[model samples]
Target chain A: MSDYKLDYLDQLESESIHIMREVAGQFERPALLFSGGKDSIVLVHLALKAFRPGKFPFPLVHIDTGHNFKEALEYRDNLAEEIGERLIVRNVEDTIKLKHLAEPKGKFASRNALQTYTLLDTIEEFKFDACIGGARRDEEKARAKERIFSVRDEFGQWNPKLQRPELWSIYNGKIDKGENVRVFPISNWTELDIWNYIKRENIKLPSIYFAHKREVIEHEGQFVAMSKFVLIEPTDKISVRKVRYRTVGDMTCTAAVESNATKIDDIINEIIATKTSERGETRIDDQVSEAAMEDRKKNGYF
Target chain B: MDILRFITAGSVDDGKSTLIGRLLYDSKSIMIDHLEAIERQTKNRDDGEIDLALLTDGLRAEREQGITIDVAYKYFSTPKRKFIIADAPGHIQYTRNMVTGASNSELIIILVDARHGVIEQTRRHSIIASLLNIPHVVVAVNKMDLVEYSEEVYNNILKDYDSLAGQLGLKNVTYIPISALNGDNIVDASQLLPWYKGDTLLNYLENVSLADDINLTNARFPVQYVIRPQTEQLHDYRGYAGKVISGIYKVGDAVTILPSGESSRISMIELGGKKVKEAFAPQSVVIHLRHDVDVSRGDVIVKDEDIPLIEQQIEVLLCWMDNKPLIAGNKYLLQINSSRVRCVVKTIDYKLNVNTLEKDLSPDKAGLNDIIRATIKTAQPIAYDSYQKLRVNGGAILIDETSNVTVGACMIQ
Candidate 1:
């Protein structure tokens, strides 16, 4: 007989898988949000476990911000192809061209906030009732209050006060027409949990997550990678440094940390010793205020 | 690493939030920005020190009112274990929030004010925790400094709590005397309690064994969905995708599909794209059957040798969560595992008095946030074990058919 004890990781995995199945069984049409980030990659891997020996019941969807890392985009496409799954990519540039979004001033301004418009538009376009993302509670204070099955109104706004009560493993995914549920299977998994899972499962991720030499400029106490969309000031000096991204987002907003944790095990160890949070180091938007993520989430930014 | 999820419950002034804040702060879990934000908000307060309560009181309305109105989850990890602290409200009106927070917790920390030992609210919280089957209870006697760290006051509270614990049938009870404001015996043991030789709060949380919390005797697997990948690459693959609710399931174990009376053997257990020898409760995996049967979602897979009672009527302990009272003869959806069946309340056996631990048999209607024992009749025969036997299969939620909101949670008796 196989000994089956409830390890912390196993328990977390079970809960996440239960959530994923709930998403598939409850929603009319759901899509897995693939961002080529470590969290999203882990979500895809869990989805695969959710319906094993069978193709994923839901399609994989990616909201491209146009300023994505080329390596990340390449990795995303290759992963989708390798898994033989349908990949749907919606671009914010198209949304901007279509006059759905206003262009911001300065080249370094982020399309991170503007992606919400395109995301809602894609949900409307595809009539997806549920969009499963890899949002964790430990990421921010506001996110800490989020339900596993977060319900969004017709306008795609999240009212934390009015969320449905999720008890036990039972998730209420019922929603009115035009209203959708934003399902977060890994809502309970912390950054350390994700790193530990990735290390244990040997889940493949984009190369950007590992330490590599890249051209970067220090901006507002962050090492902003040198990209075509980034506007470098005359006083800013470009330097080459070995850095790894704790998070993957739009190149204009995502920052890198100086680290030598090239391997997954080393990265896990680094995360254990690192005092700064994944978002604390990489997400420039959250550095603004305590309620920044909360405000964005209210505005339908996943 | 061990994972401990505990709920902190007490009356409004019992320093529940302060205790949680102290734990988070002393554990070094609070970041610089979070600390700064708390500092800026509490600048005008009496003490120049940051009011740690402000960290968990997330809502603007709650912050302005200086009270916790909802459940706020706080996470912190020591070198020993990771902890998920559910900071539940203490107000009598928000009993639903307390129930929600304590539902999934393995431990309940009932905070008692040493100056006011074992108040009505403490009894209320302890009763609810016991009702929810929280295996462990930690009675944290707060504000020892106010009592001059008097051993007499601490012992008085402990004696009262022990009596209450005996009444509630709580076996594993630990008493720790500390002051949340002074930061004593929380993360670190205080010198004031040198005579006290019990484990510190963090130490107790780190070493608590939660492996037995999940029932592993009766195997219950509710099929969430049937996976039939009709593609040519893997044409003949038919797997039942769902989480193992209880017990260990091996590849060659003889299994029975409930409601269908079909028998089969597990051909394989696949988890995360890898074939495993066996699967158990809470692990989401796909199980391959030796025989192709007409199985779908809501159907349960159990051990062929040991089958559960398949019945249309069940008596359950229900906790009403909706604002509307639970009226008999009203149709509601009772969802267990993947099975959703229309059920009606046959009778309200008794309403539980949370504070006094008394059963009011005269109440015909279960009000909002009331824990009541009721008998329910379902439209279809559902497979289930007693709550004491299997929490996953025995536990269910009542959904209001009209609003589609989960109005209550039911545990089969």
Candidate 2:
């Protein structure tokens, strides 16, 4: 055995597990925000380790944008069934029609921002006082300043200027009837840490994360996958390339990077040598400015 | 590798943010896009120079106001180690933010403007660092370039800081003179101050030993959950899962479960899905016992020889952090480790004046952002050591049951 201790990862894991237990003990109604991504998958596995002798006290929730990849959706349902937990899904298309969220302009116009309306509606519909997300702070600049237990106002809006002081492991999850808290157990984790952890734990992820041949078209300097939700321009020409998604999001905006990292080890080595960030490669929304994530977070987008 | 978590505290215009920016920049931990964004924003400024402080000032309000409003964390790494830097606000009103940042930090870097020497904020940060029991402290005298790199100026600041450190009972104090704006003696050694000899900031950070920071003599294990794999192959397996708070525990060691007084021997210690011969402090592992006792969450396991005191009344220094004043007779949940019990504030002994280091005995109410010495009576007996003995078990948080908000952090006397 290596005498060197993995203290950093150990500390991160302990803190996350402690937060998970606190969620179970404190909240009257709590749910995990599962998206069939690597972060959420690690969260599910941690929840299982947190309450192994008994079933999970809280259910798993997924806000479906209605433009998700088929493999990702299938993976979500299968994982929920395997873990034997209740999976609650709220569709954005229903919210667009009933809640009058926004007009479905074109096939390519993003409902990504509209999913916030659906998510807040679901939180109110289920009376969930705490919603657990898998957002890591190292992913974005705005996320770097977030508290582990981030409080939201009655409208689910985050005021960055006014936030409670979180000291030690004590989390203040206090809110009124309409107000709620967003809990991020993996807030301190980095992108590289998540990848290394997944490799170590042998956690299964969707096939889209690995390199495969797919027909894609270039839009605004990003290789957008050609899907039913994508509106291909008349002059745009599609080409086949071996690519993999650095992050999973709405098919219209999420892009893929050219790679041949088919296995987990290869992906880890690729990430170590890659120059661009994960969000830079896949998230089209962040290309506008530096504070895009902060703006979205203030408007109650997870 | 061992993790070293540290915090930076100083007054405004002390180049606190600049030092952090230089550390990140020199370590090459920042991404190209982030650097490019900072570069683009720098060009927009009238100075036409890259403002290193802009890298840490993330909020729009902070950028517009040109002041830090809250604590912002920055992560970076070198080949030798990984660091989590907590950049705390320096304003007097944000004292609570400084305390929150220094609570979990192993080291504290107090920046002092060489021209201004020792000021009120310098004393405030030094006292807070000592009060929080930070193991190491680095007093970086910044802006030496403006002072012509004078040794007399550096010595004067050192003399004033020594008096403050003496009053606060701080033993480990290291001073280094540098100009954070010009990047002198921060990441690289300075040729200007060759008369003064010491390790550079980066070198000290990489070489500072933290093995002794943890409490390895006193064993503490707070049970977080019970792990049992109810499968055919592992049908009779039962493990108590928790993070080791302090000390080292080995298989076949004699242990005592708190509140129950049940004695047993550890059967096995498993970490990261593998069995281990021994487990030490700060490691999260699942411990199996030889006997299946009635142990659940909130139970603590300790070495038999070093049993904690079981009592219903305790004295503590409480840092109140709510908008409402603390009412003496009101009951709140006092959580220590994983165990929580109803506690009533018996009396507010005194409040510490942050600047004078004196106690105000006439203050009957502990208001918001006040640090007071108080005694509390618990509904049930809790097992605990002294704050200096076991940090995990000796500290607690006061929760308002009605609001479910953590209102105060308490350290046992």
Per-residue C-alpha lDDT of model 1 across residues B329-382, encoded as one tens digit per residue:
878999887889999998898998888978898787998889899999999999
**Residue A92 lDDT in candidate 1:** 93
Candidate 1 chain A weakest ten by summed lDDT = A1-10
Q: Quote the TM-score that chain A achieves in each candidate.
A: 0.97, 0.95
Clashing pairs in 2: none
List, residue by residue over A148-192, the lDDT tens digit for candidate 1: 889898878988767666666777776778999999988878898
Tell me the lDDT of model 2 at A157.
87
Q: What DockQ does every candidate get?
A: 0.59, 0.44
- Candidate 2: residue B213 lDDT (0-100): 80
Cα lDDT tens digits for candidate 2, A1-302: 23424567676776787788777666789889998888998899888766665567689999999988888899999999998899999999999999666655664677878888999999999999899999987788788888999988877888887777787666667677888889999987778778878887789999999999999997766788998888777988789999998888888878988889899999988887776778887888787666788888998987
State the lDDT at A286 in candidate 1. 81
Q: Model 1: DockQ against the native? A: 0.59
